[model samples]
Target: MSDDVTAAADAVRHGEVVVYPTETVYGMGADATNPDAVERVFDTKGRDRDKPLSAGFPSVDAALEYVVTTDLEVAFMRRFLPGPVTVVVERRDALPDVLVAGRDRVGVRVPDHDLACDFFERADTPVTATSANRSGTGSITNPSQLSDDVREAVAVVLDGGTTPGTESTVVDPGRGIIHRRGAMADDIETWLAEHADSEPDA
Candidate 1:
């Protein structure tokens, strides 16, 4: 890996936060198991430490390894991944309370972007994910366009050209709540609908 990628991955390994690209938007990330590292994210974003954040993995199985993944979680992972969709599933003891915001479940995703996928390869563990921007604001889709404050604040930035400029569609598969109107095309949605039916309930 180049020095920049190595440094970014090292930051994560050391429990520091790093800003990186995902197909949907720029995301700030930390080692999913490190509560203190996770705390730094909230402090940096001035985020409500109480608000739960989701995690992104390279693949469904990768995510399942970190948490107390259920059949529904695994089913949903099989159903919608390498696409812009998030799933909420039961949390495991390994996750910190702050990451889940005192909630019983945690969100998980597998972004369709290559650079983001590399995180799973680099960290060899799950990484909590949230948009780089503050709460209630539009997600930053283009890393190149990020303000200096946002850019400089992060330990490293991986340029992934202009992203699709849309955030991932979220779904609470655990509760059967279709939380987000995902950004994929109709064909993909139709595929999701079809696959969802075939999968057994959690």
Candidate 2:
């Protein structure tokens, strides 16, 4: 497992796409900061070029570095992140257009899984957090769940066993919006209500 993680990190560093496990599901990623590498992810997943890709960071602080946030939101991140929520916030220009899709906002994640984040940290780059599946298909939870096309498209698949099968709940705290409700919606709502100065718009 350790050797595989090392190889995966190396692969990412060299601009190769790799399939890795996240707490929510398996993700097909490459260095999010690398435009060519990020393009590979979009190509592999058959993802829409205009659709933005979320980023997975090694830690909460690292993830926060790419987005605009307030103290209350940072507290929310500290509390629920490294878990199963993707926080959407104002994007920083440091992120490439491929990841942000020319938008001013981007979704960010700090995966709770140790192996995945270790790979990200070792690679020393943020990774695209899009699911390892063809567009419009269900996410891959295990290697066997990968389609033939998807299986053939990647250079490595780090089988971290079966994932939790629920995609992360996506929230835009600045707008008080829940973009997608999944594994952690209720908990996030409660936390936001307790911490946010005003209620979320949605």
Candidate 3:
């Protein structure tokens, strides 16, 4: 592993936060299973407690460990993950309740960024996937884009050059809904239509 990843991973394991790149944008992440660390992420962003954070994994299979999914939902995930998509699913209790704000569903992502994935793998923990910016503010696409406040809050900021500058498309495959559109909205919608049988209970 790279020294930067080692440092970032160590920070995460020690319940500290880091600003790291994702395929879509830079993310401010802390260990998802650590309620205090996760809380810090919310505090840093000025995000509401009611607005739960997403969990990021190294791969779709890793995400599935914490997110309950049907075969159809798994198929849906296999189709667009490791890309810019946030797939919300039934929470499996593998993560802290704080991550989902006591909700039974959680948003999860398998970002297609090697450095970010390697960091998560070394940290050996799921990470909160909220963008590295104040809530309701624009995302930071590069380390230089971070505000002074944001920069000062994190233990480390790994610069992986500029990102795509878009947020991940948030979708609930279980509900057959596109909760928020971003990077791959059309692709997600099309997949949902093709797998209408997997729709969640109304």
Candidate 4:
């Protein structure tokens, strides 16, 4: 695990992509600040550039600026972050275009795992994170489920056993933010009910 983490960090530093696990599912990551590396992730996944992706933070505190503003949302974030939830927020000016599809918004999450954050820190910035599988395919739960291309594309593999076998809850609090039904769990809904209106990003 240590060797793989080391190699993953090295690959990210050299503008290579790697897959890392979170409490939810495996996410392919690269140096977010490096446009070329980030573009590769979009290409590899056949993702729509117009569809912005979230950036995983090392901790909730690291994500404060992006989401926390009002006390209700702030408190909500303090409670739910570092867990399996992605909060929508108004994008900051410096955020890259590829991050949120050049939209006025972005998604922020601080995974409840050390290895996930370690990858972010190693990349020297937040990395674009999405399910490790091809777009529209079921997410890979275990390293064994990963394809040969995924394996060969990465410079290192960190087998954290298996991921949570599910995806994170994505919530949009502000106006014009609509999330599909049944995509998130009940707990996430509870949190959203109380803080959605207070979210500054909306």
Number of the top TM-score candidate: 3
lDDT of candidate 2 over 1-202, digit per residue (tens) = 9888899899999999999999989998898889999999999998899999999899988987777876656776788889889988777777898788898888888999998899888888888888999999988888899989888878888999999899899988767778999987998888766656664443
Residue-by-residue lDDT tens digits, candidate 3, 114-184: 99899888889899899999888888998888988888899999889999888789998877888899997
TM-score, per-candidate, Cα-based: 0.86, 0.94, 0.95, 0.86
Q: Which 10 residues in a row give candidate 3 its minimum summed lDDT?
A: 193-202
Better of 1 and 3 by lDDT: 3
- Indicate the residue-level lDDT of 50 in model 1: 77
Q: RMSD in Å for candidate 1, one decimal?
A: 2.5
In model 1, pairs of residues that clash are: none
Error of 3 at 117 (Å): 0.8
Q: Please give the lDDT score at residue 107 for candidate 1.
A: 87
Clashing pairs in 4: 174-202
Clashing pairs in 3: none
Q: What's model 1's lDDT at 158? A: 72
lDDT of each: 0.76, 0.86, 0.88, 0.73
lDDT-best of 2 and 3: 3
Off by over 4 Å in 3: 198-202
Q: Considering TM-score, which of the candidate structures 1 and 3 is the better prediction for this target?
A: 3
Candidate 4 at 45: error in angstroms?
A: 1.1
TM-score of 3: 0.95
lDDT of 1 by residue, 16-130 (tens): 8888888788888888788898887887677897788888788877877766765655766786787788777887878888898988888888888777888657876678788
Ranking by TM-score: 3, 2, 1, 4
